[model samples]
Target: MSAARRRGSPAAGLCPAAIDRVRIRCPQDVRRAAEALHAIAMDHGMRAAPAHNIADKHTPVDAEGNNLAREVFGWSDRKAWCGNSRIALDSPITAACRFESEPFWVNAQGFRTSLPNHYLAAIDLANFEARAMTRAAIVVPVHLPFGQIGAVSFNPLDPALTELDDLFALQGDAFGVYARTFVASYEHVMGSLQALTAAARLSKREVECLRWAAIGKTDVEIGMILNRSRATVRFHVYNASVKLNAVNRSQTVFKAAQLGYISLAS
Candidate 1:
């Protein structure tokens, strides 16, 4: 079933009864909890993936066999019992691991598949070899557009809860809702955190000058356009370079552009 696009609207094809009984925990806390999720693994011997950013994962692996965390989510820090771990950006779990036990995220084109084994680490593994993890795991698939795939995994081996699929099936909607709300809150927190970081914030003039320099403009030319001396223009550019921690003017411009302090286009 397709997730409803309406903000604050819970996805359709969910149990109203389960939702009503379900209480969404602190979303701010939940989003922050993506870090140290290992505690959740330790708490119940079950791992939980709160948000999986697929954008960074849509690439080749690095030396450590992992991509930048931006692939799924960022600003991930452990708030409670969660930690830094994301699901496969393109994996079978996207569909096969839905709350409804149907394809969680699919379209007319095809299924978004990823490293299936990694995504389903906490999922059922009777057939595949089970790695030593917190005894159980619960995975809630959260699908967002713009190639954003979010899933919250929870494995609570609480003896009181058994019949894995049945129990998950029972609480699926609540989990889905929690996943939805948490993603929204997570984005907001990131925006704020980014703003809080201390770094030289460029003035409009400096930003424009830096952007123009990135296109191979000379200081004299840039100064003539801005009605400033080349020396003054160079100073601003140099200050920006320092803030960006670049070794040279070109590297400074590149780093500044990457951080989005200025545009690279001339």
Candidate 2:
């Protein structure tokens, strides 16, 4: 295990007092907790976007109905941060977050992750400046249950600063803990509906079928391996797709893997 995981507290670098202040229980607590993290980020010469759902266009709002992005980071331009805009679709920073769970810094040059991810390199950074808006940022990805991906990015106040290597090194882990805690708590308290339908449950046979399908097994091939008829295998797979609300066979397998019904690794 990594040293950070080995530690008792995920918020290793933060004091207990600061960590306590970062917890959110109700919608009212959202702004308070976000401010606490914003203060910590500012101490390190960075501005915080306390909570952001990468897939959503609207930024998360507190009880008082203040937009966290505008209130905390002072970014008035909503489209610049996130929306159905070209920037939202083509941002390298958010793209990197999709591949990387750990904290990573990015600039116009490229992404710097704890582990080398060739996936980040494959992302087109052609209009990085125009898309990403910031010159550079230290991003913490918060991958939540049911495939919801949240993120918090700390950008340097100075527009001229494009490099965040030193700042990220000093504060990446702490930022990660704070970012995850704030976003996760906020989501738990504020999320109106579950990502999956209530009927989204699979049977043993369905799981068995998906496990085989995830590894590229055809229905006939899976039936041969599982000692079932191809028609029976198809029935289980189709039932699994209905439960998962998946449109196609591939989506069925993908959602099954996401919900832990089947292991894609296996």
Best by lDDT: 2
Residue by residue across 36-99, what tens digits does model 2's lDDT show? 9889888888888644578777777889888777776576664347433554466887787788
List the candidate 2 regions with Cα displacement exceeding 4 Å: 1-13, 195-201, 212-235, 238-251, 263-266
Q: Give the number of the best model, judged by TM-score.
A: 2
Per-residue lDDT of candidate 1, residues 1-266 (tens digit): 22222223344335454333222234334323343333323443444444444333332112233422332233133421123133242233433443233222222222222223334333443321122122334455545432245555554536344224433444444455655554444444431233223645767777888877877889999998889999999999888776666678887777677666767563
- lDDT for each candidate structure: 0.46, 0.79
Error of 1 at 29 (Å): 7.5
